[model samples]
Target: MHHVTQIKEFKVIDTCRDAVVINTNIDDYKAHAHFADIRGALECISLINRGLLPKSRYYKTACKRLLTPEQYEGLVERTKEKYININKGVRR
Candidate 1:
């Protein structure tokens, strides 16, 4: 049997009723990139929320690099929480 990959599509509607469709194949590399992007965005938010964004450059870099480790798993959990909330139509 041959393996087949399914492409998933996401649909979103704006306030003005404009609809947008995004096609995501989610290959391994793309999936890794998406995870990294989400982590990086969450790390930025964490730094800003903790008032560390304007701190030492070294600290900011280190935070972004280490914030997704097993010890810092809360960051990923927070990201998922925000994702769910947004999907539930809870606007920030």
Candidate 2:
């Protein structure tokens, strides 16, 4: 049998109007769970920075959490400083 090389392209038809409204209520329990997730992830990163991999598992239970850009940036800085201090002591 011979192989076919050319492939056919299909056009996507747009037939839906942009006038849809979705009303939903966000429960407090979900919000609190998300907050706990962010806090736990931050704590895990902190633990990893301190070179304690085994203890980091304690903070890996929550999910679907959101963190602000500023908070993430701050966490990065804090983790960096932690490594810096660790290396500083080793080089002395």
Candidate 3:
């Protein structure tokens, strides 16, 4: 039998310069690093975009509940751009 992947929808519950909270059908998840700056957050986002799940157990679980790889890549791209704009005020 062929297995199919389900693409789940994600909602940005809250976000700031240093952190973001996301919600999906499975559960709510937060992405943040204590004592880290915006750069750290950007790095984290990059890793996620590259298919590297966060080290935190909660994040690992949440990653499994997210969208398919293709859909997720699109979401990550948009999110990264948003963060960059908010932090650097870069207009494009």
Candidate 4:
């Protein structure tokens, strides 16, 4: 069987009262580019755009639960956390 890949997208409307989830697959190299580590900072913001999950609190919950691996999990996680929380409400 072929392996499955998942992408999450969120859209929000009316003071967070509306939300949705759109799913897609990354079949090639470039398809995964949108989700690169350099892109992690805007992940939650992007998720909000499609509406699957809420912003702020959900993002904070995700950040707080992030665990680092002993080897390849330091700079990436730290940078992502900083970018995600820098403005909290605004995503840059």
Q: Candidate 4 on 13-50: residue-level lDDT in tens?
A: 21222222222232222211222232343464444344
lDDT of 3: 0.40
Cα RMSD of all models vs. native, in order, equals 17.9, 17.8, 14.8, 15.1
- Model 1 poorest ten-residue lDDT run: 10-19
| Alpha-carbon deviation at 60 in model 2, angstroms | 7.6
lDDT of 3 by residue, 1-92 (tens): 22222223323322333333232443334421221243443444455657565665554444544544454444432233333445576667
Q: Where is model 1 more than 4 Å wrong at Cα?
A: 1-36, 54-92
Candidate 1: tens digits of C-alpha lDDT, residues 55-78: 445434443443334323333222
lDDT of each: 0.33, 0.27, 0.40, 0.32
TM-score-wise, the better of 3 and 4 is 3
Best by lDDT: 3
Each prediction's TM-score against the native?
0.21, 0.22, 0.29, 0.20
**How do the candidates rank by lDDT, highest first?**
3, 1, 4, 2
TM-score of 4: 0.20
Q: Where does candidate 2 clash, by residue pair?
A: none
Q: How accurate is candidate 1 locally (lDDT)?
A: 0.33
lDDT of 1 at 61: 48
